[model samples]
Target: MNFVGYYRLPPVRGVFFSPAQEERLLLLGCQEVFSDRCLAGGVVRSGLDRALTALEPGGVLAVPSLHALAGAMVDLLDVVRRLRALNLDLVVVQPPIDTRSDAGFFEACQILAT
Candidate 1:
């Protein structure tokens, strides 16, 4: 479904996506605009750690792009770490990252160089 409705909505609360995340999510085709992955209507929560697991089940993920690539790495790492902890599958456009393989991490590190 086109995400026109979602992108148009004013952000609700907590850490909503940046414009980039909205674009990525639009490209990924989310059926609904999820504020965050909450459990029991906020009684329990996945936070970033468990939240990213949704990616494997067809959630399009996006990490913030800082002023520069180097700056962005920290943000990217946090995103990756969270996703990795959840064992979520991801598709990175710039530098390919496969947490399962050392080679992928090594290669991605090189590719991510600013």
Candidate 2:
């Protein structure tokens, strides 16, 4: 199982996760982690784009949380859309999100929207 991690940091310097979370992801077998630093509420993410492009079909993407994907709901939805289009599965550590199932996918989108 090929797994990848995605995360973001607020442009100003904010830490969203502790070492424990990273350790957990490593235990879950995430070999690569891609992170982006962006201003609050900004949608343009180069790291995200690169991660998406690097991921092959049926790959798994691990995120710490929905909020980490984007500060704005629109950007969050866009990220989800791109992930869906790529046929990549999303595993959000917090809130236990998995986009492999229909309900899970819907719930992930809902969580990001709200």
Candidate 3:
């Protein structure tokens, strides 16, 4: 399956996050994975918009970690809502959450609570 992915790694950390994430996605049998790494909430990422537009119907957005979406829960929630409207599945790898199921919904709520 084709996937568009998004992630963020703090610049201060020096270590890159995308390499590991790309490896994971590739191992998952993803034919293609488009990703962008940015500082969370630092700026509007145009790559996300392009990725969303590139997504085929029923395609997935593989986010290796949920926190990469935003630093705030509200921002994350907004992103989730918008992605849902586009009928794209969000695959959050670390916690193994998929927004396509009830369990995922509950897990998401749990994450938002923290």
Best by lDDT: 2
* lDDT for position 78 in model 2: 78
Cα RMSD for candidates in order: 9.1, 3.8, 3.9
Candidate 3 TM-score versus the reference: 0.71
lDDT of 1 by residue, 1-114 (tens): 222112222224663445665566456554433333223333222333333433454233432222211223655555445544554444433444323334365346446643
Q: Which residue pairs show backbone clashes in model 1?
A: none
Evaluated at residue 41, the lDDT of candidate 1 is 34
Across 3-108, the per-residue lDDT of candidate 2 in tens digits comes to 8877776666555444655676677678867777776666457767777777889988888887766677787787877777787888887778777754566566
| TM-score of predicted structure 1 | 0.35
Candidate 2 minimal-lDDT segment of 10 residues: 13-22
Residues 5-57 of candidate 3 have per-residue lDDT tens digits of 77655554566446777777677655566554555447455656777788887
Model 3 RMSD vs true structure? 3.9
Better of 1 and 3 by TM-score: 3
What are the Cα lDDT values of the candidates?
Answer: 0.38, 0.73, 0.67
Highest-TM-score candidate: 2
Candidate 2 vs candidate 3, TM-score winner: 2
Residue-level lDDT for 90 in candidate 3: 82
